[model samples]
Target chain A: MKLNKTSRNFKILDAFYIAMMILPIIFGIVLQVLTKPVSEGIAITGARVYFTIPMPVQDFPITESQVNSAIVMVVIFFFCLYITHGMSKKIELKRQHLAEMIVEKVDSLVKENMGEYFMGFAPFIIAIMALSAFSSLLTLFGLYPPTSDINIVGGWAVLVFFLITYYKMKCGPINYLKGFAEPVALLAPINFISEFATPVSMAFRHYGNVLSGSVISVLLGSALAGLSSMVLGNLPGFLADVPLFQMGIPAVLSIYFDVFSGCLQAFIFAMLTMMYVGGAFDLETYKQKKARKSAKNKQ
Target chain B: MELAIGIILGCCALGTGIAMIAGVGPGIGEGNAVASACEAIARQPESKSSVTTTMLMGCAIAETTGLYALVIAILLIFVAPGLLVDLLVNTMNGLK
Candidate 1:
């Protein structure tokens, strides 16, 4: 009749997981309520004219509500951190005795299976995974997901790009750059552009898709509301009916927009990051050697 | 003016909701992957570690799609273009 100790622990973990998921929703609601009414406006203070002159745009400014919405967004961002911390903790607990589950998983996989070349890649995977999850969840509760912000994603791209380049230079700068000279030096500029394009595309692709989806969703909701009011004479058929109608529609879209697409973009970003770092470190040499061996066998 | 404001506000709300559509692909793919992995593990319990590793990797890849959608949604809500007559006037006057 006695439950196993592990079973009890799992029950506790399940409870914790539920709480972690709910916390963001609760915080988002509270924050949204507290910071309602914030919106865009012209600035009276420190307004710049061209590059040199200063001019006040407006003396009276937007109400405190406008700023509150932005503040609410900031609060939601911090809430995301909590969700990430909880997930990491849960992962750590699941991999009992391993102080760092993600690190151990990647290290053993790469060292024993993939190769020592991927030794330092585990931490990056875990960090990106956690960050993506946090950012995505914020979107669920009507907050500006931080990753969508160019400044934020761009910073991540630049940081990883530079680090990869640095590692490549340290590993073998000549060999690293030589990869760009493939086929002919005439193709070097194309190679360089392609290399740089990875980060640029990664940042904008994510921003563009998510931003467009939001716009589309808002347009649909309003259109539905308008149709309901006209047809039902404000009897609120939309309250009772439109949700059910849109459910089938938006539910399908959410599958791609929210779940599948988001995860793939995160993975692509991380995978491209690994490839960039590997190139910098001349790991392509190992790949080339492998290809050469297969070619020789065929010959 | 009311109609215009309504349009703007409605767009904002609907935009946020629709932005969530980007999540569909990752959800189905990741779900299928995890399901297949679970089935595989059930069939051959010995391959649990390998299966789990692959599952996680697939899940991670699936997650990026949702993240991209989130990015776009956030931008729509926070930085969406709107017509501000006063700002438009300032901008036109070369005083912005």
Candidate 2:
């Protein structure tokens, strides 16, 4: 069969995309093979396998989540660099238009939530949103997603928490501290707990969602394989080993778990970060704005 | 000790199932939130985007309680049994 030039090009692209998707898993399996097994003395309880880095000084053990996160960071950095490099001033390229739209949207989102003065936060919010979304989605590529690790999400939440505290302190230390006691003094401990709970909840929300999705999908996959084995055990040779049911069912589940839940969790995390930080500044501006509007009305 | 362990596990399994009942709160809360958001949008069609965004944010926050319950349930299923047994063994050994 003779193939057209476009179809030939598409075939090459398809191969490349497939290879890109499979490369990490292949690399991981290769690494697993190459690495020396842990000694029988140390009991490893979890499902995660750690790769030991053979350093000149000492071997460093790193979890799959860390390795995957580093890979994700590098990929994002390079992709962003490549996409944004040598950009024309005019919106000639679709990439340029997309980039511009993203910037504008993020800027507006920050402005709307945090006010015009806090537009500087747009980049941070955008980065968190993108990182969270990409990390969660990385599970689709058979990688341990970064967000599945509590440390990654917790780190971002901690940053947000500090920002919230810094902004509150910037507003006024006395008022910020005093505000905790307000509406009633007895609510101070609850307020304090709630304050700490913000970051904890934010971190757990993303981590739990992604981790649960991963756990469910893995359980489903294994259950399917077990079912297949039980049902097909009597069948001869290769037919017994083939898990036919495992092919398309998990992909359907992944659409909801990996794609929908991942994106939703990412959006929620970013939105919460923005809302909490913005809210700190919004309090002062809101009061000022209200006062100004009331004065204007009276006049 | 084995019987105690079994009872502990059974109770935890039962408790975990009960904890999952918290899922109903978020389900109802989200449904109400969306219903109210839709009503708001219907009343002020121009404010649709803002209302929807707020609704989603509210839903996400409301989901926190259910997520907490889920985390607890997951821990009970995967982690708590082992830890409980370990604790029981340790206590018995210490008593010895």
For each candidate in turn, the TM-score is 0.53, 0.81
Model 2 interface RMSD over true interface Cα atoms: 1.0
Segments in model 1 whose C-alpha atoms lie over 4 Å from true places: A1-25, A38-114, A176-179, A234-252, A283-299, B1-96
Model 2: per-residue Cα lDDT over A143-206, one tens digit each: 6687987888889999999999987776567778887997899999999999899899998888
As a whole number from 0 to 100, the lDDT of residue A13 in candidate 1 is 60
Task: Report how far residue A165 has shifted in candidate 2, in Å.
Answer: 0.7
> What shift in Å separates residue B11 of candidate 2 from its native position after superposition?
2.9
Q: State the local distance difference test value for candidate 1.
A: 0.59
Docking class for candidate 1: incorrect
Task: Name the candidate that leads on lDDT.
Answer: 2
Q: What DockQ does each prediction reach against the true complex?
A: 0.13, 0.56
**Candidate 2 structure quality by residue, lDDT tens digits, B1-96:** 889899989988998999999999999999999999989999999999889889989998898899899889988887899899899999999999
Q: Show the colliding residue pairs in model 2.
A: none
Model 2 segments beyond 4 Å from truth? A1-61, A229-237, A282-299, B39-47
lDDT of the candidates, in the order given: 0.59, 0.80
Give the 10-residue window scoring lowest on summed lDDT in candidate 2 chain A.
Answer: A40-49
